[model samples]
Target: MTTAVAPPLLEDTQLGPKAGGFYRYQNIWTGLGFGIFLGFVAWLVSHATVQGSNWGTDMVVTCTMVAWVVGFNIGMGTFNAPIHWILGHDQTHEDELYAAGVGQGSSRYLKFCTDHKVVGTQYLVLVMVLFGVGGTLAMMIRTQLITPHSSFLDPQTYNAIVTIHGMVMIIATIIMVSGPFANFIMPIMIGAKDMAFPRLNAMSFWVVVSAVPCLLATFFLGGVNAGWTTYAPLSVQAPAAMDAFAMTIITFVVSVTVAGVNTIVTVVTMRAKGMTMGRLPIFTWGTVVGGALGLYAMPAFLAVMTMMITDRATGTSFFVPEVGGSQWLYENIFWIMGHPEVYVILLPPVAAVLEIASTFARKPVFGYKVAIAGFVAIAALSIMVWAHHMFTTGWAPNLAAPFMLTTELISIPTGIIFLCTIGTLWKGSIWTRLPMWFVYLFVWNFIIGGVTGIYLSDVPADQFFHGDMFVTAHFHYTLLGGAMIGATAAVCYWFPKVSGRMLNERVGKVAFWMIAIGIQVTYFGQFWEGFQGMARRIAYYNPHYETANQMSTAGAYLLMAGWLVFLYMMINGWRHGKIAPANPWHAKTLEWKVPTPVPLENFLVDPVVTSDPYTYGEGVPDGQEVPESAPAPEPELVPAGSAPGDQIDAGGAS
Candidate 1:
């Protein structure tokens, strides 16, 4: 008698055709075209009506940029559901599936696709594009600073590059891990079908896309020379570009709020039946905390930017000191959001690295609850420490003591997180992969960043370093060395599941070493310059500092080339790398159990969790021998565009 074998669940299935009617025709190109058309119309009308008025070019620029966002949304069918509700013809279920990109293939990526995976993919592309722009700008700044009195760019142009690069990198890093992994992998990790609010997920991404043009337009409008901080008095007197900068910030705030809500709701409400809070992956916890912190922090940014707009557009005194407003007031509100937002950029990637460390070390996450408590403590303390940025301002010398105390105190929770990472790696069987290489790099760099930060947190030491290249080096170490490194590890760890192919490890290692060495050389040189009392944000420097500047520039070029190599590897891997198995690392997380090229609804059967997600190493906690069954026979690889043979397994594998 022959025993029948059931078809494997880990196989791709083709989806049906699109069903959203006319909305299916609208995509990114159509949105761009419509946006340009509306912007031109607004420019013409505003130029005639408001150009020579008291508001002048600021009003005209603001009007044009706002129109572009509105038109883009309209053309992208962002208002379709609301419009349908008004017309008494709400979308059918079929339309909802089509809007989710069912069977739309590559075109779905360009459209206002509501599929969380599609949105995640879109975010990944956007992050890369932003990095490319910002890195190019960094190269320009480094080239200009390669020697004292270099004339590669005028002072105004150099300042513009600095402003744009800072904002762009900040924006990119904020969303880097949270954007792709949180939206794509987090849902599956929790054993959920999709995010609770899929349409809002799509909206969060597209809104940010709309803001990019406004930021870029600043260059043509005579540039925002007020730095990324856009301090008052300087920002108040800047050219029309300041208006565009304000619009970008306002738009970004909206995106952050929406994304924050979506992340919270999805994790809180959508986990599988038995996937309790304790069972959820560390990365999921990280994403949720980061999202929650953003909700608390971003509104402050919104308020400050809005007030700045009013100060410029309506001649309000919100930030104008001559009219009863204070520059100290501006600094206070900006840093309120500014400091917490650092954790917003930070927590997600750090969480991701812990997840990676656990997986590659073949061990459960050590002190999981303690790590969660550490994340919470850091978030709580982050908000109270903002005034530390204003320590040198002397707006409140009496308050400085408290702010410094809080700043130093935050490092305790941060240290707990570090201990958890080291504990997880202690005496474990480590599988050193591309991801783990970055993990090791993170430990090395973050120690330097953390140690330097302590000096800055002390008011006496901060007084000497406040405006110097030391402050610049310290931040780059934290943001670039720490957070960005963690994000790179996450991308490598999750690349297979996202792309259905393995990353090119050989090329990736080459890229990794280059970046590792480059970061040290680059930042160490800046640290040397700062120790020599070199001031930051200067186009020209003393001849004595030229050698340090050249060293930093040389290292910057290596960093740029390394990133380019890594980018190429990702592109090549996505197109033609070896096909990845469903559980390439034999990871225990729910996301790994799903098929590579995850299906429309992620799983055919909802996973019912039985234990904590990380059950790595051998045997039970009580030293009991776990029952072992003979391994299932290897399944043949199904060719592209074909379904596997159907056979019965009534109670499906989770």
Candidate 2:
């Protein structure tokens, strides 16, 4: 058999500004202008061609959004490389460097730069914007619930706010950890220079950028009133805005699929010499698993969304019951992606927490292999348990038992992960840093979330809890409380490395307490209302439930205020916080070994992993594995000006 030859690696060259060509004219503003122009042209054509028909408006919107995606990519220089290839031309070394954003300074963040760190930073900003939009909608929702008969928003308006809010937050949380930390931190942790596919990394981010406008455009197009799930019958009946929502999901699936493949491939093939699978960091494992699960789950979302748009635009009967389509089919396909998505949002942050716990507690992670097993089991069982979400639908009564059993069984591995966290923190002298504080918050909040989830997982108990404020409170505990909390900790933990500055610990702590207390007050109020038999998704409620609703609303305002403060802290810290040195936390991970404001290739010399990263405490040799119960006297701090992996032949920047 003939052997395949690999392409030669490019020699390192100092990157400079663009060499004056077509790319100089391309950026996000250019992309926006092109997209808008194309969308308007498509709208004019579709309106001129079709009028006074059931699918007329939907066809216009769908065609317009498609045109926008294509036009935006064209204007962003996304098609330049491929077009060059088709004409027997290739990007020179300088073109590649320019695309990687070497000397462009701040403007690179707005362009289609391929640097993984730049993409990660872009995802961070995107997450904030999404949360800002979703949080505003949340405030509107809580405002409406403040009084029993409040007409703060009309029914259709309230439903639209809830629909967009659910979807925006879901998308934001799914990418919160994986988008930022997975891209910025994971490559360094694995000793890779960059992702296995860097151009795809940049494309993944810019594609999501194109999709966000489509989601926001939904409101102007009369809103998607079918909720975030966009369940059948209602979705099929929704106005043209539903077309925009479907386009957003379809576009987002491309981003997730591309990003997932890059993450998995980077970890699998691009890992540094000697960085064997067993020696890989916990966060690396967490990110890879999350990426893989997202790949497994997103296809269903893509399929359902495609079918949804077809039904709306082409007069198909895929989800239209009166036209012989089945609502049960929609629910099945939706939840097939839905339940695993919960883990996709959860795994990265949970793994980050484990990494943080090991660092701050001055100990090795307890049961490292077991934690990996827990992630695997959670992903494996998540797919089998999706039908539990349909217990109340009455579509398949017989499958409920099997679904319920799988749901509860999945909790076993979840408990194991929790136990590992506790075991790691048990006897070590814990450093109560800002990141560690969030870890404590995660433990407390996730316990409540897990226990309440069990109550809802039971078939008999779910009869009361499903579709009430109880389900809302339970999932908020899981997603917002658990996953979001973990993401916050990761931001705090890695902020110094990413930004070259220390976070404002004082203000961060204040925001942390307010948010923690607000979560308790808000969800606890909802929990009480659910127990009192109050239904969900209603603008009007009985007068008797006003007190609880008021409490929930008041607590929601607290959450909003806390997040505003957190946002301010982040911006101010990034702009004005004290300059940091390499390895401020003195952690052993390869990322910490790198400089603050890490360089273009990550390392001047490639990293060769000699041992596991979490070798803390005294008397433990550098490469020796620490067992779950292993302990020693409190480890001495690394002297100022030195870090754990400083001995490696690597370069650093101040």
Q: Per-residue CA lDDT of candidate 2, range 519-592, in tens?
A: 99999999988988898788889988899999999999999999998999999999999998888887888888
Per-residue lDDT of candidate 1, residues 1-654 (tens digit): 223333333223343455686577899988999989999999899899875677678888888989998888878888788788899988887788888887667888999988888889999999999999999999999999998999999999999889999999999998998899999999998877789888888888998999999999999999999999998978988888999999999988888899989998888878765566667789998999999999999999999998988888878887778898999989999999999999999999999989999999998888887888889999999999999999988789999899988999999989988988998899889999999999999888888999999999999999999989998999999899999999999999999999999999999999999999999989999999999999988999999998899999999999999999999999999999999998898787888887788887786655565566677765643111111221244223223224221221111111
lDDT of each: 0.86, 0.87
Candidate 1, residue 263: the lDDT equals 92
- Model 1 TM-score, 2 decimals: 0.92
Off by over 4 Å in 2: 1-21, 618-654
